[model samples]
Target: MSFKSIVRELKEMRDGIGSTSRRGGSGSRHWHSRTKSHIVPDVTLAPLEHVQQGQWANLPFDLLVDIIRRVEESETTWPARAVVVSCASVCKSWRAVTKEIVKTPEQCGRLTFPISLKQPGPRDSPFQCFIRRNRETSTYLLYFGLVPSENETDKLLLAAKKIRRATGTDFIISLVADDFSRSSNTYIGKLRSNFLGTKFTVYDSQPPHGAGMQLNSRSSRRFHSKQVSPRVPAGNYVVSTIAYELNVLRTRGPRRMQCTMNSIPISAIQEGGSAPTPTSFPQIIDKHFSPSPAAKGKGLISDLNHATLSEVPVQSEGSLEGLVLKNKAPRWHEQLQCWCLNFKGRVTVASVKNFQLVAAVDPSHNVSPAEQEKVILQFGKIGKDIFTMDYRYPLSAFQAFALCLSSFDTKPACE
Candidate 1:
């Protein structure tokens, strides 16, 4: 039989003697009345005796009925649940006492990982689609790696539809470089528009079957357009070069060293979008890649504790008036114990794949080739930060990630 069945049967056997002993021992005390020497009627106070065996079994009414009911709800439960509406099938005593154990609504695990598109049949891939489309359940993580085909795109859309219906708000969509079909020149822009309400993050890097794409000084890494275009079309969202590694699945081998720096978006391909000469994207960032000391706070609370204010309270509120501005605005985080703001800005460049970031204003440094090699090795050591990006992320996600990065070397001010 199955393991659960084994456990259930074992549980039932153990319950009989154990439960009986517990119940039988509850009133084991004895009391005695006055003796016959005084000439009054003599009485003996002793423990109450259990009923005789046949006397217990031959009871005509409800007392016997209750005894059976407790056994079913208890570990001795023989699920006398009816076969039909009324027939309990076998033993009459248990059948009379049967009832169901209750279950809570949210007790079941909601989502399963990795919905395969290749293996068809009642394998439940479409159920994932239904869950996303219908929004009937919530999933914390989703992984879709269907190779680019109309069928695959259709399946992906079906899943997206479900997420939209369920969330009643735009859901975040993340796709690897190989996820889309060879549909058309405008596919990326179209995908962004179709998912207009939802947040979109499209990665631009070669998959395992291809060679790694090298980045340039500008931070916008470009690929040969013999098939795939170098530029991803612009849309109403953020697009930039991020470190991409091959072997998204490879686990063994002296893991390949990979890095993609100096990134930019497709929209910034225009002349104005690109940075000025000599002020290359990487140069600007490398100038300011210095590690800052985590300091004590400078405000009154710091005074109350007699502590100094931290140099940059993890979150920087750029301006108090503009929460909606793509700029930083003041917001309070109680756990961080200070009022702060968050601001994210970008500088996009054309022609090159590794475009520089404009908003990362900091003290300049000459980034050496050795330093660059070290950053690439860091990606090899920690792959998650390289492959994933959170689009339109709230400050909390950034803060938590920063907290994690703090454990690493100091965190980079990446856009």
Candidate 2:
């Protein structure tokens, strides 16, 4: 039957039913006793035709792998492992693809641990390491995948410990290392932060057995017999220095921590240099609260007013060497009523224990308002006692690594 004819017949049947109902009901009380019935459609829908789907599912497996590879190689792959793990959960095929491209520990950059920290696994185990804080001693512990089996667990087996002293803005840390026997400890070097955490000085402590001292002498034997070693030499044994430049500053709020690390000069540490005296913590706090004397005088006020009208330098983006990094220095925030560093750019959030050291053409610049600044190093937190560093071309791996260790100046949770 045609659709139009079927529809007309249904409409007529509905009209007849309505009329019959009206006729059955009419007399007074009987009008209210009429019965009604519901009508439902009895039509069936036709099945849909099959069509082609998107080609994404049919993409070559190698092509998908190439896409992932590019992402892994990017500079912003800080949380790369987490991103890859997420991709694995997308589908069975993606999971298989990601597994093949996963980076092993040897392939990835090194994971550093704070001094005195212990790892929590079998000594001979492989890539991952766990780090935790020791609340009682206010110290950090590091654990690695593989440690020598003969190394005693009870004693602190530390290659180096970079500590942020309880009191200074200076990144000064006490370092101790195992003696030649690998059984006892010795004071090896002192890493001191300079130029407001922009540079560092490493001083080698004098050996306990000084030259010309008779080892078999009674005095020497008595000195060596003590459980704890004698105090380290306070003289000049400066070995190297590290300088850093602050490149980018990413700040969203006043509460978030602002930090970074960059490159060091080969010449800065070639011969020993004098360590800069650290400014006291109390002095830093007082300076933040104190108002400028220029605000108090009429003449100084006019000078300051003139200075405010001057144009400020705009940061330009370019190669790492050409980029200027300014140290805006900490300023008072009226809204926050707290001291804050003016990074002077869109603040990018950085993770803990991650840092980079970039070499710049000019490592030094005047701190005047008109001068363009350059960053020598950039560093940030990656994890507890862990950070990443990228130094300029001149620094050796050992020098860069030493400077990188000096960047951890913040107090850990245990403290």
Clash counts for the predictions, in order: 38, 41
Q: How does model 2 score by TM-score?
A: 0.27
Q: What overall lDDT goes with each candidate model?
A: 0.20, 0.30
Give the per-residue lDDT digits (tens) of candidate 2, residues 31-68. Answer: 11211110010000011111012222344788768755
What TM-score would every model get versus the actual structure? 0.16, 0.27
Write candidate 1's Cα lDDT for 4-27 as tens digits: 453344345323323443454322
Query: Model 2: runs farther than 4 Å from truth?
Result: 1-185, 194-199, 206-236, 242-349, 361-398, 410-415
| lDDT, residue 188, candidate 1 | 20
Query: How much is the lDDT of residue 409 in candidate 2?
Result: 47
Q: In model 1, where do residues sit more than 4 Å from their true spots?
A: 1-182, 189-261, 264-358, 365-415
Alpha-carbon deviation at 402 in model 1, angstroms: 20
